[model samples]
Target: MEQNKTLVTEFVLTGLTDLPGLQVPLFLVFLVIYLTTLVGNLGLIFLIWKDPHLHIPMYLFLGSLAFVDACSSTSVSPKMLMNFLSMNHLISLIECISQFYIFASSANTECFLLMVMAYDRYVAICNPLLYPVVMSNVFCTQLLGVSYIIGFLHPMMHVGLLFKLTFCKSNVIHYFYCEILQLFKISCTDPRVNMLLIFIFSVFIQSFTFMSIILSYSYVFFAILKKKSAKGRSKAFSTCSAHLLSVFLFYGTLFLMYVLPGSGPCENQDKMYSLFYTIIIPLLSLFIHSLRNKEVIGALRRIMKINSS
Candidate 1:
């Protein structure tokens, strides 16, 4: 299959920038990011598991998200860090594809997890009485199962479709990772079909999840307003605000990158944007959602107390 489809066996990635001045600084910066992401995400998952108070559906999804974010960051950052430290950015065709597969699946899985979390919130707020029964352990497990199944399955289609394209344009990929658009640019074969499929997939996945989250929150908004107590309304706002911010940050960046074409913050903006979503987003997720939460804070205190005792 490869003999026919790909002539560019080993592609050289033009790592972030060609400037020698920024290499060490960028390396140091991303190094800190990678270490922080790993520790924070893994620590959050452990915190959730160790704390009995966090055994609910929301925390379950949160833990899964931390897992997926860790996976997403791992798939790209190690290679990116290595590339930053060394001049060797050469990756085999198989390696590139495998890397994207992992990253893409992790990303798609994140979309689903966020969607399910939104639904969890919907049930809890909209159907307050039924939420306990509806979002029971068994049901939550099933939801998680589906989120992962679809998450993994979604990228297989892209990779399968990608394999059909032949690459002959140039072996130098101009981004940090084997990004889909970068791949399409190098393919000698017509990537219109591939682009179309990607567009369709991106639109469907993002829109469906984005719209569902919006709808859920819309209902949640009204429900919050209907509450008699000002404190209850204010508390609800505070609780959901963080979740909504994370959602907007993830979906917003993705939407802009895909829909707006060339809106990067600077030259070689693709690399910058990719770094943001792939590396920075994971770190942001922990702070924007889990770390800011009162419950997570309480759980941390409880765990610390136990360890100290």
Candidate 2:
């Protein structure tokens, strides 16, 4: 797996904006986002660690989600922010590939972790009698380990295949950051195999995880309907609203990014939608789940009280 001719050692990233006047403003905006993402995620992790009430499987998954979200944003946002300030945003061949590998791995892990959390909620609501037995600490740990394994496994395959490609043409990437789809476009070699592999893995992982979440929630809805007390039903559904909304936003963007038709008139729009999946959705997780969590708020209050005393 060697290149016949090394055409380009580095690539110029056409960042989110080209306007010379708006560069500094955009940098500030993204800087704020990056800081907020870090604080929200780390705060969530700290709360989960400190609070004894949050020792359940659901919170365990939530903590894992926060960790993945933090890593995913950190992988891209720093470089993107740097690009905004610099005149030439050049990334080396090896560095670009490494960025894509880490970003994809973390993003995939978050997807599976979301599904696992949905299942946890379903078992807690629908099979309350067996929730403790079905999802013990050992079982949750195994699920997390499997989630990370599956996440990294598929991306490594594509990355290894990418090393086989011959990049001997233009060295300008149209996006704000490095991505596999964008990289595949510039390859001088036949990328049909890589394209097919991407399609298969994307469809397989998304369809499987989506189906699992759907089935779990279906059972949850049925169980909610069976409840005699309206209050109980409302409380149960309330807890699920946040998770359901997050699933919709994430899966909606992801499906549009990978599964939708790209050769049609909407190709550019497809790329824009992909930004939501890669960047915006991860930011949303901070606000939608962790920032508003009751446990996190309680932990903050305790920390404040201790400092005051």
Candidate 3:
């Protein structure tokens, strides 16, 4: 047992591709995506901070989303870029575990945060009279704190169990980063406990959160229908349309990546799905909120006008 603990000090990360011709192109493409993710998310955070008019609960949640996206992208992209640029695509065992923990925690945090955002929309649209009271500053802060607490602690259990496993098998992980499933695949010991824990957490976290979002939207829809004036209905729908779109994109990719049964031997397809959720979704999220949101656009225009004048 002791010898097995010392057996593997590092692990090779098999990135998205091995083709010599595709390496540079892939690197350039992801570099551009990473940069966009940074600018978009950070830009949103800056706008939220600078514009006092935007200091509301919806924007507050959006800011948190942007912050999480930036952190999650940073957790993976730098090491991924290094692998793309170098012949040796190796990550130390400690580094791999650390990356896995951060990525998983951030992913979980985003899931809960989206649910919170949905609830915020629900209150704004369904119970306008109670919106301010329900989503007061203190309550919003508490929700955010809970999201991070659950996100960070849930993954700690997985990492603790992971460290107990002996890795006498191949050290080459079959993914771009140290994903939980890929790590489990490389474990020589029985992974039933880990798998069971994953199943339970997935049910408790993903299922519960997804269902809550659905319920919130359902109420929001009915409330929108109750609005008599067409302009009022339009105004209400506009507020939530962006959030609804974001929810679809985030949950859709997540479901495809995790819930769907894999089509036989299609490792690349799985990786592609994972890429959408990890890389593409964050980039899309920025545009979804900023482009569709009139307030965000107005705030940007105001900032630009002030700067130019």
What do the candidate models score in CA lDDT, each in turn? 0.88, 0.84, 0.88
Candidate number that wins on lDDT, 1 or 2:
1
lDDT of 1 by residue, 110-184 (tens): 988998998998898889899888998999999999999999998899899888987777899988888888888
User: Please, what are the lDDT tens digits per residue for candidate 2 over residues 227-299?
Assistant: 9999999877876778888999988877766665364365457656756766677789888886666666777
Question: lDDT value for candidate 1?
Answer: 0.88
Choose 2 or 3, whichever is better by TM-score. 3
The estimated TM-scores of all candidates read: 0.94, 0.94, 0.95
Which 10 successive residues of model 3 have the least lDDT summed? Answer: 256-265
- Model 3 has a clash total of 0
- Residue by residue across 127-157, what tens digits does model 3's lDDT show? 8999999999999999999999998899999
After superposition, the stretches of candidate 3 with alpha carbons farther than 4 Å from their true spots are: 1-6, 260-265
Please report the TM-score between candidate 2 and the true structure: 0.94
Clashing pairs in 3: none
